[model samples]
Target: MAVDAAPRRTGTGTNQEGVRRHNLATMLRQVHLGGPTSRAELTAAMGLNRSTIGGLVTELTSLGLVTVGSAPAGPGGARGAGRPSPRVALAEAGPYVVAVDLGVDQVVVARVGLGGVVHERVRGPVDPDAEAWQVGAGIAALVRRVVRGAPAGAPLAGIGMSVPGLVRRSDGLVRLAPNLGWVDVSPGSIILAALGVDVPVSLANDADLGALAEHGRGVGVGIDDLIFVSGNVGVGAGVVAGGQRLEGSGGYAGEVGHMVFDPEGRDCHCGSRGCFETEVGAHAIAEAIGCPVDAVGSLGDVLDGYATPPPALHRIGHQLGEGLSGIVNAFNPQVVVLGGYFRALHRLVPGDIAAGVHARTLPAPLESLVLSQPGLGADSILLGAAEMALEPLLADPVAGLQASLAEASSRLAG
Candidate 1:
């Protein structure tokens, strides 16, 4: 009989110092995700000894990334033989990022700190006819407003932008944002030019960010497999399988709106006849609600105003479910989050949408499926953008902080 081998975890750290750094990152990530964690709990969660957890916590505290909390002892509360393990949390006044959710209808900018905390935020209307650079300038203004709230001595790690269209993952390049009327634009450099600041910048699809946020800290926190359906001006999706985002080749994976939804329904701006957006996008919803397309900012907000869902919304809800059914069959995610306008639709026509999904999805995938609204609500993409900006600091706290401080010093000198 052949002997079977147990599966091993990949990416075993090779260098001694590298392994230490990785452990530090792991500890920080645990505390960042779970908020304040006791030393004993960190040890248990990280599979590390208490002494190592204590050292990591101490270093993290010295680096200003984490703050130590009380060690009050109690039963079944990560207690130990000696004094209770101290609780560690992300420092409230440590580092932050400028996060921007640049939607076609509206834009939200915020200064976000670790542990998904929003220090301050500002919102602005996006003019559909405005140029991409103008939009960047507008976002820069919002960034300035939010930056005013940053604590003294806190480092601004970088900026992250959430766009409504395809963005190249290799570089924070906006390849095409049809809703924003942008193509091959560099919003990062534009904003930096407007602010005269030097910092790392990240841009990703809004739906992708929404999925990232929802998975990391929102409705799908405990669920590893989930899909986030975005119902902004268009229909798109962000897929997370096994707790990792599925950014396809060229990073244009989640363009469900362009998926041929209907063959004979209506002509889409993408030159396709009856694309998903044609049937279930903002225009379709606006048409159903008897509101002008321009009058709509957030589809969810618009739907929320109605006391009772209109009968026309039922058809849209069914269509939404049919679209999601395809996703459910393909991905078999544990949860499906309804974000953007779909949130309100899910709230109002839960039965209609649920019926369509259940009726169409494969039975097996349906067995472990759930339809949920984003727990973070409109802030999903905003926080997701922050997550992207904060990636560097989370990866290596010491080096990341040093670089951010140097950049901030350079900005001040200039």
Candidate 2:
């Protein structure tokens, strides 16, 4: 007889001490995702005995990762059936990660804590025409300012940066960022040198991080296969398949902007003709709407009229959908989330965009596909970066925390 099996979860293997660490991370993640939960619920969810859950909760409480509080009274104004199980939640002032979203025209830095909370943030503009090193210096300065304001004694988990271009996953290097006019820049080292810190750094594409943020904490949560498309000064995508981010060979899988859509279209900075970016990029939209390339703010103001978008905006939406249809046909994703300018445009001219996509793509994939806007809005990339920084800690909380503390101690002594 032919039999079917259930899907297996990944990254659950552990060493002798790995069990303890993994259990701690699991508990923390549960509370982080579902909000405050009762101890009994956690025990049931984890499939662990009550004693083990108690011990893990004690350790977490001692480390300031979570706090245990009395459960609320039942509907009848009396405590629940048995002894009321204490609720657990992430500590409000615990450790945090520094998240940087380096866009073409601005830099945003945020302090994000466990459970995907943004405590504080700062933003400043940058010159896209400036030298790569100059931009790096500006970003480093902004990062320093944000770090300085972080809670005292909070363990610095790591730094996660989201760049508006292609990044090599092996090393946090910017291979090319056409929108920012940067090439072959090592932003991680530049920022680390500027800060004189020994913290770990993770760098990735802005759209990639946005996809991750949406999948883990936003609208796409629990959706394994989806594509996040971001339109700003550039167009790009982050693809997730089988519950994992798909970074192709050399980590350039999601450069959807470079896909040629028109053979006789405008020239792209990537040295290509008629690329999708040349059709729907912010600069392209601005040009179509009779605005300067730097007049994105004014362009946004004009496009904010969703009830009656201009002809130029409608054309942009059509072009965007045309480009996205190919993606839908090829990847057949469960959903396609729009971010950055695309989100706004989608809100304004969803019908035109849908018409374009429906006209181009095959019926099956398009029928099951969901087109939506980002839930986190402007915060998606930053929150995703924070998630990158917090990943290691979540995988092995005890070891990660110990290493961070030791590094902090060493820095102080030196």
Candidate 3:
């Protein structure tokens, strides 16, 4: 996990004090996620004792991370039950996150609060062929606009950029992005330099972010193992196994678009023959119907045309199903989410794909399985990007606490 630089240090605190604050922040975050809970509930959720929860709540209250609310009377809300304990909720004005989705055609910028509220977002066209520098400039402009619009003193913790294609996480360098025609572009550094701030920036593939977003708040909630397939100009999948995002060895775990669907059908920009993108991807469907991919007028028209099962559509759907079946058997995920441009095509392909997976998979994993379009469509990726940016804050309470302390220290030194 990554986080923005530590905030200025507050009055020379000892290491023990820092550790105490970190524990308190962690406890508060747990309470906020579980929702208005009592000290007992917090202890249960954090695996800590009642005394620890009490001390943590006191610290969080002083720092304005947690607030006391009306407590529940336990079990039946009976008046004769034991005294109700104070319930806790996150404070409204905690630090914020900036989520940016850098798409092939547009950029989506969102200012999100700790509570998952999208306080602001801007979506519009961006130069598809813009140089990496230009793209960073556009993002910086959007980020500054968001910062300006935030409540007068809102603290921006960090920025998360959801990109399309392979990203090298080590330095936030984009190793390759065929769609964007970018190579070795350091988007994080560019954005930080442009914004004149050194906030920690995280970059991940769009589909990966989409999976996080969907799992965090959308259709995949409560599902620990799943796959999210995003179909647009290209097709990609994000895998979550055992409740963790799978970035793979090189962080390119989900390049479904490059899967070989046709070895002799057509040429792909990826220099592969009959890749998955040639058959079921948005561009492939559009080309199959002899229309502009963007002009195909939505997935409905494409799938509707598939009812006749033309040579191209039938073969494409069948092959796409073939690829998906392999995934079902290998992972036996609880569910599979199909989103992006393919969402509109769900009505037409779900039955076929389900049948394919059922036919190919063992009986047990197939018995209670589910495969469908993500309940969230285009917005899924955007929301996912926002979630990615907020991930560090959620996963690492110590880093955020350290940042606040560093900020306090800087102010005093000045």
Best by TM-score: 1
Show how many residue pairs clash in every candidate, following the order shown: 1, 0, 15
Write down the worst ten-residue block by lDDT for model 1.
Answer: 1-10
TM-score per model over all chains: 0.92, 0.91, 0.82
Clashing pairs in 1: 300-341
TM-score of 2: 0.91
Best-first order by lDDT: 1, 2, 3
- Candidate 2, residues 263-322, lDDT tens digits: the string is 999888899999998899888888777777676733444466546776887787887888
Give per-residue CA lDDT, model 1, range 156-217, as digits (tens).
Answer: 88889999888999887889888777889988889888887778889999999999999989
Q: What is the model-wide C-alpha lDDT for candidate 3?
A: 0.71
Please report, as a residue range, the 10-residue window in candidate 2 with the lowest summed lDDT. 1-10
